[model samples]
Target: MSEPVIWREPVVEEWIDYNGHLSEPYYVLVFGHATDAVMDAVGLGPAYRSEHDASLYTVEAHVRYLDEVSLGVDLEVRSSVIGVTGKLLWIWHEMYADGRLRATEEVLGVHVTGGSSSPLPDEVAAAARALLVEAPEEASGQIALRR
Candidate 1:
């Protein structure tokens, strides 16, 4: 995996269920937003949406919370391509605050045609392949886990 990619911002309202920290659901939201950024980086953005009638859908996700993320903390999510085969892409992410690791998530996504799970067009696959990062071997773990 490569360096983590900092995200836009985490809104104050995102800090729900505060026993003095961000809620569980918000972590997923943060990761989701980061994934959107990845999609854009891989050439699947608004233009792709308007022109190709294609998109990606999450098939599974496993997240591990390593530490608490308190309110007002500045966090960034880093992602890397773990694996890609046929229509499936496996990705790994880590969330950090002030350079400290707080959480990690692994996701499996399927490139689809419109809302269906049909295989992605060759062009789309090629674009995504261009952005894939080589993952380390022996990176085995649960595909979905919650802290």
Candidate 2:
């Protein structure tokens, strides 16, 4: 099997906030792009959506920001398919900058067509399953108050 896809994005000036750091929403945006890349890798990309009106809809996401990022840095996101079902997919992405883990996002997406959940194509399902790995320990966890 091939290695999983790594999505990369440069931190542009527009993504910075008044605090002189990467903004909160841009992290989600980068993760969203990573999700799209995964869909494309599994044959659920724009072509598939246009052909069958089927697409993956993110129903939930949990993002953990572990460090602040500055502008002009290139961010790399490594994505993995942690779990997959006939109609649902669970993916995790780790964002890194300067060789350090900066953030992580775990997403749950459902295959949808005509506004209803539907089973993924057999080929796509198999492809997604091929990429599955053990879920991260922090995945699906809630932010707890540090006492």
Candidate 3:
């Protein structure tokens, strides 16, 4: 099992919306950064990209906004692997600001060839498993409205 990866991101001006809160696209960007951190922890980073010519791509994503995040607020995004099957991995991410749950995202990604959407190789699957972290039977200290 692996520990949760914590990523800190400060809200930027471009991320602000008409409501004076972080925009939807920036939320995805934060999630994307968290995903990269996880990948690096799993031994799949730029080196792996160059060596294996492989990488993971998001195929599906669902995000639920529980609270609004304003600019200048420092946010923390925690991520962990929920499940993995074949070449597909399920990831869960939570955004927190001032220790409050602000948003949650469930993402499904598939490992593929660097330049194309092809199934991952056996070695990639094995490597991913080595870093796989079993999701808790239930996440504590956070309210999850969308499961």
Overall local distance difference test of candidate 1: 0.75
Q: In model 2, which regions exceed 4 Å deviation?
A: none
Model 3 weakest 10-residue run by lDDT:
135-144
Q: Assess each prediction's global lDDT (C-alpha) against the native.
A: 0.75, 0.94, 0.80
Q: In candidate 2, what are the lDDT values of residues 1-147, reduced to their tens digit?
A: 346679998999999999999999999999999999999999999999999988999999999999999999999999999999989999999999999999999999999998899998999999999898889799989878999
Error at 1, model 3, angstroms: 6.8
1 or 2, which is superior by lDDT? 2
Candidate 2, TM-score vs. the true structure?
0.96
lDDT of 3 at 5: 81
TM-score, every prediction: 0.82, 0.96, 0.81
lDDT of 1 by residue, 1-147 (tens): 345344656537547574777788888998888888777766667788779787778998888888888777777898776777778877777888867989888888898777777665666567556667776442456455777
Superposition error at 19 for model 3 (Å): 1.1
Backbone collisions counted per model: 2, 0, 0
Q: On residues 44-71, what C-alpha lDDT tens digit does candidate 3 reach at each position?
A: 6899888888888899888778899998
Candidate 1 segments whose C-alpha is farther than 4 A from its true place: 1-6, 11-14, 136-140, 143-147
